[model samples]
Structures are given as structure tokens and as C-alpha cells.
Target: MEQHSPSIRAQAVALMRQGVPNRVVAERLNIPRGTIGWWRSEDRKACGETYEQPTDCPRCTTRDFDESAYAYLLGLYLGDGHIISKRKQHHLSISCNAPQIGLVAAAEDAMRKVMPLPSVSQRHRSGCTEVKSYTRHWTCLFPQHAPGKKHERRIALEPWQQEIVDTHPWEFIRGLIHSDGCRITNWTTRMVAGERKRYEYPRYFFTNKSDDIRKLFTDTLDKVGVGWTTLARGSDPFNISVARKASVALMDTHVGPKH
Candidate 1:
């Protein structure tokens, strides 16, 4: 019989630590299934933590979670993030356009703050960077997740979730606006005293197809004492405009453009 190398055994241990089952690790690494279990037991004895499927919810087990980070992540998920559930596994995927690298980095940072254990990975696709994590408690944290497009469904936050958002409204709005909104300078020319003068002003715009989600965004802004206007009635894609100097300044203070 042939023996496996130390590196192969170490790889097997690493995979098991990432929540991969013993049978799957054995098959992937071509190690004996019996030895995989023995190795896990030995590793647990040495480390005091087992590589086993969590019996309780990760959110419940986490005692030192940052509520502000979680709220911001919730806003991001409501704006541009999505969850895919397959069998017993769930994946959270958030994509930022190529130009918004800072927002992408911020999303990854928030994910690390919320769930530090699971590995987060990034991939590039069609001029966008997608950050994803494999975790079971994604739905638990964002109960607004459901099948079908977000606009077609009624989206509401729970009381506890709302409390978190209330405490950190700026961060929540930052995540939401960074994901689906934009800040730009609007310019116009006016003829005054026989001379044409050009003036430029800053404005913020948030567009989404879902009325429920749009309402949620506007409601949050309202709670934060920021006023906004609608483009028109029956707009194909609903638009919320924040053009007042005061409101723009307030948003600029809290949620500036993504770098």
C-alpha cells in the first residue's frame, strides 16, 4: 500500500476546517475516508474546535457582531446583493461595477465584519467584480430575501432589523446608495443681463424597478431627515431625486460617490 504525503494530509485538514465534509474531502484529496475522520478528531483535540457542521445558527452563536456593519450589509443586500439556496447550502453574492472598486472593497470589509469565519471569494465578470460567501445564515440576517425579482415582491424589514438600521441609518443609507444610486453634477445655462451663465450643482439619484424597495429607500432617507423627489408618475423605473443643496450636502457627508 502507498502512503500519502504530508502536504496532501495538510490540504485535507484545511478543507475539513472550511466545513467540507470528511467524505467530500477524502474524495477531493484522494485520501482514505477512514483516515480523514481520524485526522479531524486529532485536529480537534489539538485545537479545541471541531470541523463539523454547526448545530446552531452562526448569527446566534456570534456574540460580538457589529450591528452597524450588519445593517449596512442588509442595505447592500436589499439594493444589489442576492442569495442562492441549493439543498443545504446558501450563497450570498454582491456585485460592484468595475469603476466602483472602493464600494467592492467596502462590501468585502462588511462581510468580514459580519461573518468572519467563512471564506469570501471574488471573481470578475463582464466589467463587474462579484464578492460571494457560502453561509447558511444569510437568509436569517436578511429575511427580505425571496424568490423572483425584488421589485415584484413586497419587501419589509423586521422590527429588530429596523432597530439596527435606525441606530446606524447613515451606514445603511451609504450601503444602499453606493449599490444602486449615484451622485453627479448637474449643469444648466441661463441668459441673465444679455450674457449666458453656466451653473453646476450636485444631485443624488436612486433608481430601482421595485416599488417596495424604492419605498424602503425613501423611507429610510425620510427617517434620516433627508428629503427627495420623484421624477414622474408611472415611471418605468422609479426614480428618487435628492437635489436640494442641504440634502445633497447631508448625503455627501454620509454617502459620497464610490471611488
Candidate 2:
């Protein structure tokens, strides 16, 4: 590192003590930003000050953000995402199938769009990739996060969140499908005239163990004029099926299969 004169260091520290940001002080003094940051850290330590990283969280800062992205993220969270807000560990994690690299990129993009200040990373595990954003303020944006598993607890959206979902229902549905839903086709052979004809039925299915989440999904489908039905898997009514021709077409046009 290039050395700076004591006088220059003193001036930088003085400006920083007066609440001028490190970037401003660095530019004003023509010092490297990293050196300015070091000086500020040293000054704070000498004065017994604790440093707090700056954040651009939408809920905490009350700043306008990409609501379309946020609506999609909300669906992802409610479907299969989770937040860890422990004192030493804080982050939001969205798991994506390892083969679906597009969904991984989309998840990371949504996180950055909502809160760009925090760092984001992807961790590969088994057959999935976990996209994570490090920041405790995630709780502020995802107030629905709480103790216990999501399915074991009640999940409801805030009014503001509902408004965003109402505005961008398709994006929200896409997020949900990307996280916990899939597109499937069931085909059968039938006798037509004198020959066997193959008939294929394409449908979309969203499976989540949470009743409230399934309700939210169905409610959004209703808002978007898509018909859905609940199918019981043995005994658990945890599948939302969109098999109607019109509904399937609408889903294909908007959500489609996870890529």
C-alpha cells in the first residue's frame, strides 16, 4: 500500500469524524478509497465506536424498489425460500434444482433487485443450489418469516405485499412455479375411427405442504383468471392442479415449465 503523510491521514480522520463518508473524504483528499476506509476504521477503534454496515433494504429505507421483482421473490419465499436472522448468521436462501441454472440466476437477480447492498452467493448441495443474500434486514421485507417450519406455521402476506402480487400476478406465479411447481404431460392412446390415436394432456402443478401457501397460490390463480383444483396425494391435500385447457394455456404463456 502507498504511504500517506501523517497530516493527510489526520485530515481524513477529522473529516470522517465529522460524518463525511469515506468515499467523499477519499475523493476530496485524492487518497485511495481503501486507505480512507482503513483510516476511518482505525479512528473509530481508537474512539471505541462500533461500525454498522450501510444497507439499502426497501422496508428499512422506505425507498421505492422493483415491485415486480419483489412480488416474484415473495412467491419464491412463500413457496420454498427461508431466511436466517441469527445474531452471527443472517441471510435469505432460495433453493433451486442444480440443473435449472436459469432459476438460480433469476433468484439471485431478484435478491439483488430488492436489496443490492448485501452480498449474494450460491452454494451447491446434493442436487440443488442455494442462492443466498447476507443481510438481517431481510426480516423487515419478509415479515412472514418466523420460528418453525413454514408449513407448520401460518403464512399470510402483508397488505402492501398483496398489492404488489395483485399488480404482478404472473411474475408471482412464475416464481412459485420455479420454486415448487412443475409442468407435466399425461398421454394416453385411444381408438379413433380405425386406428389408435395418442392424446396428450398438459398441465401445471404446484405442490407445497402449507395449506395457507396453497391458498395463496390458488387465490393468485383466481385473480389471474386461471382455474385450479386441489388433488390429494394419498391423504395430504397439498397439490394445486391447473389442468383445464384454458388454464394450462394461460400458465404456459405466463409461467411455463421451470428452466
Candidate 3:
């Protein structure tokens, strides 16, 4: 038995391109046929980046953005990386803090303009709405994200159940404020991971807002009945502080304006 040093998949792929049969590929390598096929797929992925990579990066070519591909990406972005049993056939269900229908609409519109043959929804079977659902994947053509380019990911944050965030300027800003509390994207600023998980602050992201703008941001928080705090706890358990103590109190007491 002549042993090979590299991965069996690489060896198998080399053999496959050489016109080897599954049985021969299996027996010659002493590996399973199914494993050979799986390796072939893995090899294909190595050639292309994941769906989350910057779209049209040339190097990161994705499968055509059809219904099936959209379903997988939707699961990656809006769902829990798993498709619901109920919607395996027709529609893909997604959840996120809905952004502006206008923004989403604009994206949809842009996608349509680019591919005029099929409407995005008709061709891709994707529909956007207002609803907030929790998931690990962020929905944007550029999911992993690039700085100054982070806005690319905002479309994924659009929620359907509640009013879409796209229409409200303050809501959008609030989201920016909320997201800013997290870690700095290494693309734009020097990022320092916290000593522990969740010990890291939720970076407070902003798009070049000045001091007066920040004050207006706090004012918006007050007006919207949303409380926020962005202080560091020198030695606190959570290791961070919240500034909008009063708004949180109002929210807790259920004592403010309603949408």
C-alpha cells in the first residue's frame, strides 16, 4: 500500500479529473465512494467564497441567486442557518430587525434593474417585511462586512413584524447606536477584543456623526422611549454601563409614548 501525504480529497479530486471510476477511485485509494463525492464538493467550495462574501468579488463567485440559492442564503441571513420544515418548498421564512421597506425596496429595485429578465421576487421567491427575529447570520450581499461598507449589511437588519426601520430616521440612527456598542470592525478602526466574551462592548457604530449629532442621538433616544447606556464599568460584572437609565425605567414601568 503506497501511502500519500496530502489530503485524500485532493488525491481523489486529482484522480477524478483523470477519469477514474467511483469503484476505482474508492479501491485505489482505499476510501469510500461517498467520501470521494463529498470531497469533490468541498473542493468546489475552496474555489468560491461563501454567500456572505462581497457579492461580485469575482473571486467569490456564488451560485446563481435563484430561489434555491436564495433559500440557503436566507437561512444564512434571516433564519437560524436552518430552513423551517414548513417552508422547504415554496417560500423561505426569515426574521430580522426590519430596516426600511424603502431601503429593502431600493435593494430589490436595484437587483431588479440589474437582472431585468425576472423580477427579484418572481425569480428568487424572496419577499421582505417587518418582523424581528433572532439569528446568527446577518443578511447583506456582504455578510462578513467591510468598513465604510458596513452599510451594505443594513438591509439584512430590516424587521418585518414591527414597522420597518427604513422609514424612520431616528430608528435607523438608534440601530446605528445599538450596533456601535459592539466591537469596531477591524476594517475601519483598530479592534481590540475584550478580555472575555460579552465582556466586549456592543460596538457603537456611527457614520461620521459629530458631537451635536450625538447629543441629538441621545435626544432621539429620549423621544422614542428607548433607553441606552454606553459607559465602561471599571470592575463590574457585566463590565459595561448603560446611560439611559431613566428611559429604561420608563420602559420597565410601561409608562411612555406608544407607536
Candidate 4:
């Protein structure tokens, strides 16, 4: 009944349980090999279980999940996704119009990368493709979800989420734009001196009923030096237009047109 520091003991136990060699674990933790061996022996005796190196260790085999990918997926889910929780099961679903299959595929890829799951499947509903997965971590990842619709309630990002978005603003913007925004060629005719000239230019427009979400989008854009203008009030879907030449160019470089 010798007392050991819980933190180091816990680390050692986890590593040993994962089939790490006692010598390797001791070396990695800077602890004596004899101590790790003793702990392992005690665990086997107390639990009446065998501890051996696993032929296929999940921790050693699985690829590392990218935080940036999760951040982007979070933005997409915030914009166009929904979560359905029934008891212990949670399903994360993001729907994109059939025409925007690329976005749907990207969402599926993001889901796979973020979660340690086999794959995400897609179902065609009406004109939209729903990319979805059942993961317990969905709620933990997206605490912004509430009982009502996103716009009906307040939507705010935690400081950690903000930090992720700040570091990868382009990915966040791409997810936001891909879900609820679009890029189009806007044409306008103007009189130059005595002549009338018509020109078509590319612009990015993001529309959402949620003011908080719109603010988040514009704020992120500002951080990336992308200028945007909000249309007059009383619009059906609150609109933010990025029509400035430089802003459009920047958005095009990052988001492009969703195929």
C-alpha cells in the first residue's frame, strides 16, 4: 500500500495498458524500470489480468486529428448542420444542396478526420445530400447547439474555439461561406464619360438569419483583412457582401466557387 503520485502513476498505467514496454515507459517518463515493472506486476495480480504488448495498438496506428479541420467542420455545422441526440447516441448531420456535392464531400472528409470512426455516409433527401455520423463527441465539440434554432437563440464561440478560428481564419471562412454563403459574378453597367460600360465582377455574399452568426463571419473576415459591407436593414436574410476587389480576390483564393 505504497502511495504514489496519482498523475505519474496514471500516466504509467495508461502507457502500460496500451501495451507499451515497461522499459520504454519508464524511460519516457524518466522513472526507474524496476518501478514500472513493479506497478505492472501489482496491476496484474490485483486485477487477475494479463498485460502484454498489443500487436495492433490503436493509439500507435491512428492518424492524428487536425484541430484546424475540426474548427472548419464546426463552422460548417454551425451554419448548415444539425445534431439529433437520442439517449446515449448523437448524430451530426450537415445538409448541402445536391449541386454543392463538393461541400458535402468535404464535410464527410472533415467528419472522418475529426472522429476516430470508420466513415461518414451520405443520404439524398429531396434536393440535398445529408452527410452524417453518430458520435458521442458531437455535443462536446459543438456546445453552441441549443434547444431552438441557431438564429432564434444566441450563438457565441468559446475562447478556445476563437483561438482555433483565429489561427485558421481561412478554413473557418471557407466552411462558413461554403455552408451559407456563395460567390457569383455580379454585373453592373456604368457611364464612363459619354460611354456606357458594362462589366462583370466576382463577389462573395454570405446570408444568414442569425445576427450573431453574421457578426462572427464578418469579424473573422476582418481579422483576415477581408472587407465586407452589410446590406440595408429589414432584409429577409441578413446579408453581408464582400464586393471590394481585394476582398473578393482574397475570398476567391481561399474559398473559390463551391462545385
The best candidate in terms of lDDT: 2
Per-residue accuracy of model 1 over 99-171 as CA lDDT, tens digit each: 7788889899998888886678898999899989887777888787788989888888899888888899998
lDDT of 4: 0.84
Please state the error at residue 37 of candidate 2 in Å. Answer: 6.3
Candidate 4 lDDT tens digits, 16-125? 98989888998999888889998889878888986543322123345446778877897798789999888756789998988877888899988877774534789998
TM-score, per-candidate, Cα-based:
0.81, 0.86, 0.20, 0.73
| Segments in model 3 whose C-alpha atoms lie over 4 Å from true places | 1-170, 182-213, 225-246, 249-259
Model 3: per-residue lDDT, tens digit, 54-85?
Answer: 23321134534333222223222221111222
All models: lDDT? 0.85, 0.91, 0.37, 0.84
The root-mean-square deviation over C-alpha atoms between each candidate and the true structure, in angstroms, is: 5.7, 3.6, 18.7, 11.6
Q: Candidates 2 and 4: which is better by TM-score? A: 2
How does residue 15 of candidate 3 score in lDDT? 88
Sort the candidates on lDDT, descending order.
2, 1, 4, 3
Using TM-score as the measure, what is the rank order of every candidate, best first? Answer: 2, 1, 4, 3
Residue pairs whose backbone atoms clash in candidate 4:
none
Model 1 TM:
0.81
Best candidate, TM-score: 2
lDDT of 2 by residue, 164-218 (tens): 9999999999999988899999999999999999999999999999989999899
